[model samples]
Target: MIVLGVNLKKIFNNHFQKYIFLYFLVIVFLMIGISTGAITIRTVDDTAREQIINYLGSFSSIISKDADLNTIKVFRYSITNNIQTIIAIWLLGITVIGVPIVLIIIALRGFIIGFTVAFFIKEFKIKGLTLSLLYLLPQNVFLIFGFIVTSVISILFSISILKNRINVIRRPSFLNRFVNYTITMFIISIIIIIGSLVESFTTPIFLKVINNYLTVFMK
Candidate 1:
């Protein structure tokens, strides 16, 4: 376990520059998400909150309180999106034109997350905020980590393309390169899985209490 930690640390450290880019990117996305959410809440007011509560109540009714089905779905979707985004970014970075595509992809992801969370909060009010935490935080941890890795690779590839130095970024060891990519992806997958577990086993219960309290206060 210690060895694995060290290896991951080394990989991250070696690509510190890319990590910096990823940090800025996440921050920008988060800001956009929060602002959009606030605007949405202001526009809709209380009715939106009731709608969100109704939606959650319906969703809870359909699935088991444990959240197993939802957790699995979230895990599968997040991993697929993370891997696909990274691969797309890598392939696009091969040409100068792909740089903007890479940033666009990242930005779009941020926008979606922001919009979704904001919509929920606006629709559900205080309860929506609590529920959003249960859903967003864990999965986000994984997404951000995966984004850092992919963003770093994209940066390296983009820089090489700009300098017309493809050879500097290319390695002949295809098997080794593939292994490294797999390891990084697996790390992301693990994080998502853990998040799903939290969402499934714990978050529902947490949200239940918030809903109960709000129900009483609203009376």
Candidate 2:
């Protein structure tokens, strides 16, 4: 029993080390995406900047006036978008050619996040910072977590496929992996839904509370 316990500890540590490396790789890609996104803000042409400024002004006005947002529609849209993304990742994992795409998806998500925060801060200064925080933080906590997890697992499954291509696992082990991969992706989908709920319901309220204070920055 003691020997078995020690072997289990060793296996756990081995897995931790392996996954930590993968996690680090994913994080690096995410950061690169973010940096690229932030820098892209500075590269925007004057025409585009003006258009963005106009859009932000309009959005700010809506928030400040407490205009009705179609939360249900927003919820459905968010769910649909995330579901598409999740399904893409799941499919990619199966194809084993999706490793690069999976990483790119993570990077893309990071890019969007960075661009959003940078755009706000660039335009509104401190006020923009507040708006960005209120707008993104609540929902992103879950969304980003889901993104990272899904990306890593998808990549891992893809890698497993490659490694086992030459030396296939036993039937039960293969079935276990397939089930695990599918089930885990579904769980991540559920998590993304929670993030969507936050985005639709809670984020609006958060924005509403600060909309009055944000009007000054609109002009």
Q: How close is every model to the real structure, measured as TM-score?
A: 0.60, 0.81
The residue-by-residue lDDT of candidate 2 on 65-140, one tens digit each, is 6566667867888889988999998989986889999889989988998898888788778877987777778888
Q: What clash pairs does model 2 have?
A: none
lDDT string, candidate 1, 46-142, tens digits:
7766775576565444444644654466446645655566667667755667866666666666666666677656546776686767756765666
Model 2 per-residue lDDT at 30: 90
- State, as a TM-score between 0 and 1, how close model 1 is to the true structure: 0.60
Clashing pairs in 1: 48-123, 49-123
- Candidate 2 matches the true fold with a TM-score of 0.81
Name the top lDDT candidate.
2
Task: Note the Cα lDDT for every prediction shown.
Answer: 0.60, 0.81
